[model samples]
Target: MKETPLCLTVGHLLPYSMTDFNTTDFTNPSTFILLGIPGLEAAHVWISIPFCTMYAIAILGNSTILFIVKKEPSLHGPMYYFLCMLAVTDLGLSTSMLPKMLSIFWFNSKEISFSACLTQMYFIHCFSVIQSGILVAMALDRYVAICHPLRYSTILTNPIVAKISLAVVLRGGMLALRYPILARQWPYCKTNIIPQPYCTHIAMVNLACADTRISSYYGLFVLFCVMGLDVIFITMSYIQILRVIFSLPTKDARLKTFWTCGSHLFVILAFYIPGLFISLLSRFGQNVLLHFHVLIANVYLLMPLVLNPIIYGVRTKQIRDRLFRLFTHEGA
Candidate 1:
């Protein structure tokens, strides 16, 4: 149907809209739907249940690890310290977005004020950077232990680990300040609707009206720099570890060394391969594939946060023995 002049003239009368309007009212979508796993309908309710349950599990799981480590005097070394940091980053990361996302899905609280949206955006970037930094820290710890055992304790002692952790978090927090600033630069005349569960930088860029070259460039730049540096650091650490392991007196010693790094290695590969997959798919895939991409995105983002504690707690002899004794005593 042709748009009549009378209809055009009527739209001019509405305050929320004007002839100057260059974009549609999708700035506030009728529904801020998730491009989630694609079966549609009230299936959204099922999705909310799983996500909320995962949120609770992630929080409790990481908290349990932190609590366990803090309670045990023997678990105060550099390895445990890095594990503690990983748990923290994971919990903070999930807590940063899951609650609000679940609320949006279930309670219909879709209208996030721009300020709140910006706040989420900031923490998301900050926590992600912190997580990457923690991985690098862990890789460095492994490097010291396997490469230079005598100086390992001296190099990764309390003060050094604390300094490293502090530097990573502060640096990430500083870099994250740019996101909200860049976010506000956009007029948002197009649509306020975000496609993903959280306020992602690229998602927000898609909603922008002004030139988004800067935001896109920065987002991709930071993404590559952080993830790329992490991959490089991890690879170098393992290479050194392999060299050191082979130099050891026996195959048994090498096996032990491999076992020591096994959990950390698993978590690293789990997080990265899927992240690369998601980044690739997000760039090229859609519908079912895109839906799958987002699901993997959440899992990869949460993997270290959820898996760190469990991996360390179960794999570390001291932590496991303490928990075993605790349970054994309770049974008595």
Candidate 2:
């Protein structure tokens, strides 16, 4: 107030400005930068080692399952066919992130074009939804096999499994299609630097300059409608299966039925629990640390890919026996 120089006053206020001086028009930003694990940039090299190992295992393991299912005619049933679809989804999910993630972690190459980022987001979500559907399908298969053994073949024939697989892909693709389009239409006057390791619907939505409530609500709707329904159905199927198993006269029959579902139950729990956690955290736990969100999200994606094949290999006698025979024949 004492006749301070205009330049001096402006200089003093510059540091306090809340507006992003570099914020561009919504249409102006051609690219977004991914910051891998906000405060752990220095340790990216070490972090990438395990991620690379997981990616390798996911690819090799899933591919081996596909090969075994294809070459072994005895494995050509509905359950194995669904497992093959799961393998494909796992492959898509892992490949969608790992190459870009490794590049960011190892080379510090984080700049992604708007279109490419949206594409990655699409596949990531699509595969995720597809995985949920596959799990539900697997549960239905088990229910039929255990609860209605006489009609199992009639209920889930090869053609019917193929149809279910196609429907799963289509359903997931349709739901995922909207997310990227909504994000793309939003104006990004805020910073283009996404704090997470990869592009996700919520992560990209949070960066929008306009009100993001619609996108947020729609995402939640899709989660509940798709993944939530899958979980409910899977749970119901297992309950019925258990009821039927218990009704069996002999202990051996009941034990055999439970053993058959062991691998699938493990895979379902492994996939859904982390996914539900991530979904809840993204929506409600804004105060949670950024790295923790990143870690959990990565775990949701990587853990199933690595664990699914291992669980199936160890728990399913057919897969285990075939793997042993294949290895032994190779050695011979």
- Clash number for model 2? 0
- By how many angstroms RMSD does model 1 differ from the true structure? 8.4
Candidate 1 error regions (>4 Å) = 1-23, 26-41, 283-290
lDDT tens digits by residue: candidate 1, 1-332: 22111100000100111122233654433333333333232565777877887788788878888888899988889988888888888898899888887776676565676777788878988888877778888889888988998999889879999999899888789878888898777666565545456666666666666787876667656777766777898899999999989988999988998888877787676667766665555445533333444456666666666666677777778878988888899999
| Collision count of model 1 | 2
CA lDDT, every prediction? 0.69, 0.80
lDDT of 2 by residue, 86-156 (tens): 99999999999999999999999999999999999999888988988999999999999998889999998
lDDT of 1: 0.69
TM-score of 1: 0.86
Which candidate leads in lDDT?
2
- Considering summed lDDT, which 10 consecutive residues are worst modelled in model 2? 6-15
Angstrom error of the Cα, residue 28, model 2: value is 3.0
